[model samples]
Target: MLGPDPRTTLVWALLLDWLGQLLILALIVWIPPALDWSIGGTQLAGQYPWILFCVLLYPLLGWLFGSYTVLHWRRLPMLVLIQRLLLTAAATLAAVAIARWLINPGEEVWLVYRRVQVVWLVSLSGWSLLVRLGLRQGMLLPDTPRLLLLAGDEERDRVLQAWRRVPQRERLRPIQPQQLEAELSRLDVAMVLTLSPKIHRDPALRSVFQHLETADPRWIRVVSPERLFEAMQERLPPALLAEQGLNYDDLPWAVTFSIQAQLKRAADFLVAALLLLLTSPLIALAALLIWWDDRGPIFYVQERSGWLGRPFTVLKLRTMAVQSPGSPATWTQLGDRRITRVGGWLRRVRLDELPQLLNVLNGEMSLIGPRPERPELEEELEQHIPHYRKRHWMRPGLSGWAQVCAPYASSIEDSDLKLSYDLYYLRHFSTWLDLMILFRTIKTVLKAGGR
Candidate 1:
């Protein structure tokens, strides 16, 4: 059982969500006038632009809040999903209220009535979650892309298991080689997937490819499981990459050498310099709290492995009590006794990393990339995890693709999962991707979405 292409599902979900929310807003604005409710003598059309802005704003904020992401809706707990949707709506409302204050402060202009505000927020939240539920049940997109698996039994089972790990398997139909042409003839066969290159050996299937030049070929997209994972998850797993006879180094290694690297460096320096200026007061307050809590050193500096396995001294606000000499430092666990109360807050809101702006300025790290690991642990992790050393292929980051997408990694398995996302970022680092990481990082700070 395989679901439709991730790109297809994600696009459809976002478009539908925006359209549905737009309808909800339209009804709310129009119904007020129909009920003879006074709206500052402005016609409903006055609110049309506002409505369009909000409808667009929800999904944009939704992206930051992880309301809409790869696969959009599947296997996530419904409670967490609803919480994200409500958070997105609440943030959008706050933004709108701020705009209203600046635009026409302290007045019920353009659907700003307190009563209508409540209805608007509740209605949007309800409709957002309702759209998610519809996507979850596959009721919204009825015309799902159908997949046909072209492989032997063992290969077919491998493909099935891989899709199952994405946890979106229910539509992959495995057929005998003899049936390839018949399956291709079906209009619903949106993707033809195979695990082996020998698929062309079948003379019948061969004829289909030969005649595909004349037939409508766009309907039959050919992809392998590895390519499918790369497209769907946007990450190249070490094993899958190797299985395709590709080395990790064979990747388009553009992370540090491309023009994006030069642009990233300039952006990092300017942004970091400005952020250090703007955030200095906040950092001072945090440092005072750390010192007041336990009269300990206010900063922690450690040498961490960096770009291409070089080492750099990373600086961070001390989030744990200073230990005596020869004390074995350990990974900080949730609710660790070593963490002070203020330290826990700093970690939750990610203030502990503020000092790294200096590192970003110095070019030891990036504003977005794979996170650097402590040198003491980096070597061991490289031994245990496949392609783990690839993390040093580019500069580390203050907040990163791994930090945003993956849970805090405390074990080997967790490290592998994080490295997958990091590799994806390294492979596709660009301005837009950096902006996305920045947006999600902001969301994380707002929600204290991490430990």
Candidate 2:
């Protein structure tokens, strides 16, 4: 149902969450004083720094943990509430630990700190849960603002099934052609028409939608069912690619050629340089381990496809024995015998990719984008997957949307799925998306589940 825009709902949810946290903090201070408890050498006003830290740190953690993502909000209210509470608790503990370490509170202050932190954690979690539950029930109630989906017989069932999976399903009612006008008039309706050549050419249906638009311009939308499926799955289907008139040659070069491209490159270089400096000791340790594994070379270098299908040498810490003279390139399977014990651990922790930061610094890759494929693999994928080569329109990346969302590709089908993620990234390329990918990538590494 077209209740509120997802982005608008997210903004409101965040506002309510922040306000709840603030109110809870205020209560923690006021209620304790009312109980005659000592505040340990500080007045309520003096606690502004802690309050400020909560204000900034909680929301940052929430965003990182997917609390602000709209898809989560579209789930069952109880599920969303539980997820938010857990995330809030985690964030609170982290913020409190960081604060304790940074401030190094004295004994008396430490007592006060522990007391306030416990109260804040409970109050904030409870309050945020109540706020989100209220929002879900009030604004996202499943009885108003109904959605009417229009599609051919073949497409209608697929579209209806998709809508049924969302929390708004109760408000989604499919209307037959004969009942369209009556239903539209009787309900607070938002109409979604699946785009197709046949539907586009139907003047009568066009007139009906045009009339609806005139009455409520923003309530009527034309969307491709395939695009909807792609979004839901986070992977482009071949049929959707064909239906949407997408072409490999139409790759969004504007993203690569624009001012943001310059900013992206600058960001890449600066972040790469900083990371390389910070990671120098770790890199040295990894190299030592590799060398000590079997007296083999410490670095592995191989040719890979890059921007605009150019070739560049990609570098990694050696993760396998030196190949026999004529061994062919192949995917790394799980528990492959080629992996040395030290190399396996390094790969798990993603230390092997630390060297690719140098590639970022060298302008051969981005800090975030589609991962570069090897030349032979790229050629094979391009042959099997439509528009696969379009991923090269931008610089390949150290970590990407596909890397975060999908497992490593081992076959043509897997490669196709990865390409869909790449296409999604290409279509929606932005600094914010890049940041999200980077955050998810960090989570993946911390869990030691390498792609």
Q: What ranges in model 1 sit over 4 Å off?
A: 1-35, 43-71, 76-110, 126-189, 192-220, 243-257
Model 2 Cα lDDT, one tens digit per residue, 1-451: 2344455567777888788877776666576667887643335545566667777777767666665653344465567557766876776677777777888755544323666677666777777666666665656433234445566666566456544433342344555666767755653555554454445466778766676666554555555655554444445544346634565445444744667667788999999999999999999999999999899999998899999899999999998988987678888888889999889999887989999998998899999989988897777777788878778878999999889877778888778777878887887777888897988888667767783
Error of 1 at 208 (Å): 11
Model 1: per-residue lDDT, tens digit, 1-451? Answer: 2334555566776888777776766676577578987633345546766667777777888877777763454466878888888888788888887877777733434565555665777787787677666666666454445666777667677666655543443456777866766766787535445544455465656666665445564565667666666666666555444543444455544533767667878999999999999999999999999999999999998888888889889899998878887675466666789888899999999999999999999899988888888877776788877777777877888988888867888777678778877877766767888997898898889878768
User: Model-by-model lDDT, in order?
Assistant: 0.73, 0.71
Give the CA lDDT, 0 to 100, for residue 128 in model 2. Answer: 66
Query: Model 2: runs farther than 4 Å from truth?
Result: 1-10, 38-42, 61-91, 94-98, 106-112, 135-186, 202-215, 226-238, 242-252, 255-257, 292-295, 320-325, 332-345, 446-449
- TM-score quality measure for candidate 2: 0.78
